[model samples]
Target: MRVQEIPIREIRRPLYRQNDQNKVKALMESIQEIGLQEPIDVLEVDGQYYGFSGCHRYEACTRLGHETIRCNVRRAPRAVLKMHLA
Candidate 1:
């Protein structure tokens, strides 16, 4: 997988809405302390990136006001596509 830096504006929420406030904070701390343990996965469609996984990590980065995030992106799978469409 190729890692790329994508602007935060391009990131969309994942299928499941993640609103765990505590978890978000913890993740943010981890990110701050050690950087991202793994790159967030994304799917690109018509130039926009939809989050495929790593919702918590994504939110943490957003909280940190990251201009861009490291991502391993590819075309969306059928299920992943449906999630975005839903």
Candidate 2:
């Protein structure tokens, strides 16, 4: 596991989620003011980055035009990723 800044466009979001607009707005404000307080968790499988959590934060950062995002990266096997997908 590691913490690093990754290009937001490189991450793959496999899940479809509806983010709370209010939360996204609040996060956008906080991120603009103090930067991202919490890094989003992502899985690195076969060198591919996959994001399954922190949907709100992701949306906020995306809307803010951030090129990269802070992430807590966990390298996992394809099987583990399949489990997440399933």
RMSD of each: 2.5, 0.4
Write model 2 residue lDDT over 31-80, tens digit each, in one string: 99999999999999999999999999999999999999999999999999
TM-score of each: 0.79, 0.98
Candidate 1 structure quality by residue, lDDT tens digits, 1-86: 56899998878865677478999899999999999888998888666788857878888999899999999988655676786667
| lDDT of model 1, residue 66 | 90
Model 1 spans with C-alpha error above 4 angstroms: 14-16, 76-80, 83-86
Model 1 worst lDDT window (10 residues): 75-84
Q: What is the Cα-based lDDT of residue 65 in candidate 2?
A: 100
